[model samples]
Structure formats: C-alpha cells, structure tokens
Target: MRSTYILSFLRISVSVLFYILLVFSVLFLVASIASIAGNDKAGDLTKKSYSYRVKAFGLQNTNEPFTYSQDSMVKYQKVADEYSVVLEPSSTIGYYALIMKLVYMALGLVILWNFKKIFKETSFRQPFKNTIIKRLRTLAALFILSDVIKLLDYFLFNSYLHHSIASTKFQLLTDVGNGVITGLVILVIAVIYERGKELEEENALTV
Candidate 1:
C-alpha cells in the first residue's frame, strides 16, 4: 500500500541516520584516545620564547618592559625549539576515553541487532503505522542511551578536573548540546510516527 511504502522509506532513512551516528561516534572515540596518548602535541611557542627571554635577562629583569624588533620577535618565535611534556595521562581524560569506547561499542552492538531487518530481505513487513512507530522508539532509545553514557563520562572527567570546574562545566554544556540535538531528532521522529499511526487507524475505521 502507499502507506506501507512511506513507512519503508522512513525505516530506511532512520537506519541510515543511525549508521551515520555510529560512524561518527567511533571516529570521536578514536580521536579522543589519540589525543590522550599525546599523539597530537600542541604548545604555545610564545611561552617558549618567553622562557628564553627569562634566561637572557634574569627572571626579575625579564619582567621589566623590553622592546624587540618585529623581525626579532618573529624569528625567535619561529626558532623556538619544541618540547614535549611528560604528561602522565589525566585520569579524567582516560576515564572519558574509556567511556567513549564503551559507548561506541554499545552502538555497534545495537546496530548489529537491527542490521538484519534494516539491511536484509524485505518480506517482514509490519503495518505501516506500527513499523514506523517501533523504529522511532528504537531510535529514541538509542539516543537516550548514548546521552546517558556521555553524561557519565562528563561527570567522571569533571570530578577529576575539579580544580577547573569551569572547564568541566563547559564540557558538560557541549555534551548537553549534542544530546539535545539528538533528542530533538528522536522526538520529531516519534511525533511523526504517532501521527501517521493515528491517521492510518482513522482511515481503516472510515473504510
């Protein structure tokens, strides 16, 4: 039926979105681990140049106003040797990394659970209304689960970075943003599914 086709299309679209989220989550987890490992190092060259100034002038003298040619400042900044910190990984970052890994893993499992129906043969069709409503519910549950895991990660990391509670708070805000967007998408899907079901029932009754 026309309604059945519409439901099928919705199912396919939602499944694609789910897979996209799964891929993104996996990439984020990988990047987080790499960052924690110090694979991507970043430093302020200006800080290093300042250190050289301290060496040239005694620490107290260096604090005094000094002028440098623009060229000199540029050259020094460029020539500053890079140094690596012996960063013992923050328990906070490590905890976050672990949570990200777990979340992605769980998403993968869920995707696998749904893959057969979404990707395989086409004979198994529920009523258009029921099919869409069920899929939307599933998507909502997935996002909610992801959000919960993210909140746990934020809390664990924030607790460790308690000295800068501000930074932790900011991280929580960002996570909330992501969660909100996903939550909204889920909500929209749910509403549409329900409306479609209601319409289908009405149509049936009228017939």
Candidate 2:
C-alpha cells in the first residue's frame, strides 16, 4: 500500500518533470542550431559566461592572475590533484555554452526517460527483468557521465577565464563528486539486484 502511494507519486511527479524537460531539451536543441546558424544576437540572450570561486589549499599562484599551477602539490600527492575550479559566468552566455546547455538538457531527458519507464514498471507490479537491470545501469552510468561532461566542459572553456577561481565559498565540485560516488553505489546495487533476479528465474525453472 505504501509502495503504491510512493509509486503513484513518483509516476506523476516524474511524468510532469519529464514533459517539462522534454520541452526544454527541444528548445535547447533548436537554439543550439540557430546559434550555429549565426543567430549571434539571439544566442547572446540565452548563453553567457559565469563566474565562480573555488578555495583549494596549497595553490601556487603563477602570479599572472589567470594561470596557477599545482604541479608540486600533485607530485607530493602522487596523483593529479587539482586546485582548480571553474564556474559559469553569470553575465553572458555564448555559442559554446548553448551547446553545453543542449548537452545538459539532452542528458536530463535521458534520465527522466528512464525514470518514467521505471515508474511504469512499478505501477504494473511487474517482476524485475533484464531490461529493468539495463535501465538501472543506464541511469547510474548517465549520472556518472553527467559529472564527467561538466568537468570536461569547464576545461574546454578555460580560454574564457578572465582570472582563476580560487575562492573557498562553498565549493560546488564537492557536490558533483558526491553525485559521482552516489552513482557508483547505485550501479553496484543495480548489478546485485539484477543478479538476484536472474537467480530467482533460474530457481523457478529448476523447480
């Protein structure tokens, strides 16, 4: 009874969000195309750079303002530990940012698509199947991929940096890292659940 309530709630909530994001995704796609078609004036309204601060310890400032190096610190750690943070400029958005938005919206659609599908399965009171496992795996992988894409997008726009982000005012990357970890945990659970389902099917056949 509780699951029914929860399932109903999730189905309706996610369905609404799904359609809203679907519309946004289509808009982003259209806007991205227009930007590519040289709709520079219109594009300016939709895309802009953002500024953010990241506070990291032991950053060796290059003193030139925009460039900083953590080679020594990374060597000491024996890993590529970066003291870098890049944030979006709240002032203006551009072509590249519009493309990023398109990617983001598309990824969100993928997530919501799977979410709605999962809810449908729950609503039907269906047994777990291989397809469900695949869907769960996809959701987990997408969560991880979303974070990775964000990091990559930041680095790609490095040329846009007027200065480095070196403030410690509540680093947002930590939240992204947490998401990555959560995604991994979910992936593990999906794998385990899938295996259990397979075993149950096997036992049923043997009996």
Candidate 3:
C-alpha cells in the first residue's frame, strides 16, 4: 500500500514536471521557427538565458567599506563569479545553439515519457517486467544522447564566449558526465531485471 502511494506520487510528480517542460519546449519550438523565418524581434523575445561559471582575470576589487547600519558594517564587491548570457539568432553559431537546445528538450521529453510509462506499468508485486527493460534501455540511450548534446552546447557556448568576451573567461561548470553515468547504471539494472525475469520464469516452470 505504501509503495502504491509512492508510485502514484512519483507518477503525479513526473507528469507535472513533464507538462511544465512540454510547455516550455513548445514555446522554444515556436521561437526557433520564428528565428528561422527572419523574425528578429521574436527571436530576441524568446532567446534563452544561459548561465556559465566565470573565471576572472585582471579584475580589481571595488569593495569600499560602507556602514549600512550603525550596529553592523559590511563591505561587498559588485562582482559575479558566474554570468548568464542570452543567445540570439544574429549569427550562425547562435542558430546552432538554439537548435541544440531544441534537440535537448526533445530528448528530455522522451526521457520523461519513458519514465512515466515505466512507473505506470511497474508494480511492487511485479517489479521486474520485460516491457520495462526495453523502456529502460530507451531511456538510457536518450540520457546518453542528451548528455552528448549538452556537451556540444557547452562547446558552442564556450566558443561564442571566447570570441565575444575578452576580460573574463567563461567555463561550463555544470557536471557533464552524470547523464552517461545514469545511463550506465540503468543498463546494469536492466541486466539485473533480465536475469530476475529469467529466474522467475524458471521457477514457474519447475512448479
């Protein structure tokens, strides 16, 4: 009963998240089309804001001692260790970045759908099923592909920043290998499930 509740909860949560992402993806798709159709205003309006970790060089500390309250005085510098930049459709690289984002969203949607289907078809009583193994494999592939696309986006962003900015060096600080790791873990679990299903079948035959 508790597991039933948990599974239901998970299904609901994933559904909520999936719909939210789907809405955003649809918006992005429209924006992508607009960008492709020479709609600069629409492109600018729908441009996504991306954050990157920054490494600053030859920067001065502009923090001056100031007393905000008489009880406590504090000084702070107006410098950002990370920055968010919006990519527009002004150049070829920007278009590539946008297309990559669309691909990423598409993969993400498929991944979520797979998860939803798995959770729907799975039960605590029958956890290891053949259908789930296939879905898991599909999800794993999507995860790995999403990770690759992410890295490509990072490279594209890095290249864009390298040519655009001079003072501060921007780096993709987000963990890149998690998707592949997760995909591999799922593959292992699928193998385990396959073995479990075989043993279950063998037990059924012996009885």
Candidate 4:
C-alpha cells in the first residue's frame, strides 16, 4: 500500500513537471521564430554572438545584448551620454543561442516525461518485466546524449563569444562528470535486472 501510494505521488508530481516544461518548450519555439521575424537585418550581421555591453567594471548577462567600447576616463553622467552616442550592432547568432538553450530545456523535459510514464506503468503486483528494463536502458542512453549535446553547445557559445570580443580562444578540457557516470550506472542496473528477470522466467518454466 505504501509503495502504491508513493508511486502514485511520484507519477502525479512528475506529470505536473512534464506539462510545465512542455509549455516552456512551446514558448521557446515561438520566441525563436519571432526573433528572426522581428530583426529584418538579423541575417546580415557578421558577428554571430550575443554579448554583454560592458557598462561598468564587471561583466554580467543582461537583457540588452551587445558589445561596446568602455573607457575609464568618463564620469557616471558621461557614461549614459556615451551610451546613447554609440550603439553596438546586434548579431544573428543570438537567435541560434536561444535555440541551443531551448534544446537543452526540451531534452530535460522529455526525460522527465519518460520517467513519469515509467512510474505510472510500475505496479507492485508485477515486479519483473522487460518493458521497465527497456525504459531504463533508453533513459540511460538519453542521459549520455544530453551530456554530449551540452558539451557541443558550450563549445559553440565560447567560440562565438570569443570571436565577437577578438579574444583568445578557450577550450573546455575536461570529462563530462555526472551525467555520463549516472548513465553508465543506470545502464549496468538495467542489464542486471533484465538478466535476473530472464533467469526467473527460465526457472518457472523448468518446473
């Protein structure tokens, strides 16, 4: 009874999260389309990156995406004056960046929805089934794919941002930690569980 209630709760919660993510995915898709439509000259821009307008001494992400010249000689009042005097050009790469972010979000939501279905299908009465094992394996592969896609996005962002700034190229030189490992572990578990199920069926038939 407790396990039944637990699974029911999990299914409900996961379904809610899945629906919320779906809404965001649709919004992102619309925003991506609107971006191209709104910016008529968006394709002509050479710099393929969204950048922070260096307002002060620090760098931070902002709604206003552009690159600008900075000066230490100017006063606070003069800063605003200078800002209006110069406007940094927008880039077409910003749209692609938004798409990358949306892809990441969509991937996470899809995995969550799959897990929701797994929980929904699970029953205390039926412990050994190939379907559950298959889902687990599929989820593991998705986990690894997610990490690879993330790495690709990071490389693309860094490359575009560097070109926009005329800065030295930076490479991310490290192994993907959590997602890869977790996926492998889940894969192993699924294999073992499937083998166990096979043995149980074989034993039942032998009698």
- The estimated TM-scores of all candidates read 0.43, 0.63, 0.73, 0.69
The lDDT leader among the candidates is: 3
lDDT of 2 by residue, 1-207 (tens): 887888789999999999998887787566556545653443243342333433333545333323335764332222222334333323233445566767888888888899899777753444667777888898899989988987886565543432333342222232357558867987997989788788888988999
Summarize candidate 4's per-residue lDDT along 70-181 as a digit string, tens digits.
8645433233211111112344346556667678787888789779878877877666678889889988998999889868876675566556545433333335667888
Indicate the worst ten consecutive residues by lDDT in candidate 3: 43-52
Query: Candidate 1, TM-score vs. the true structure?
Result: 0.43
RMSD of each: 11.9, 10.0, 4.5, 10.0
Query: Which residues of candidate 1, in runs, are more than 4 Å off?
Result: 1-96, 108-127, 160-174
Model 4, residue 171: what's the lDDT?
A: 36
lDDT of 1 at 99: 59
lDDT by residue for model 1 over 1-207, one digit each (tens)?
A: 886686577668767766777777678667655555653333312211111010111122223245568776532233122222221233444454455566667775574445434433333343445554566567667767777776776566445444433322222322445655775687686788688668878988999
Residue pairs in steric clash, candidate 3?
Answer: none
Q: Which stretches of candidate 3 lie over 4 Å from their true place?
A: 32-83, 163-170
lDDT of 4 at 191: 92
**Residue 100 local lDDT, model 2:** 73
Candidates sorted by lDDT, best first? 3, 4, 2, 1
List candidate 2 stretches off by more than 4 Å. Answer: 27-93, 123-125, 162-175
Name the top TM-score candidate.
3
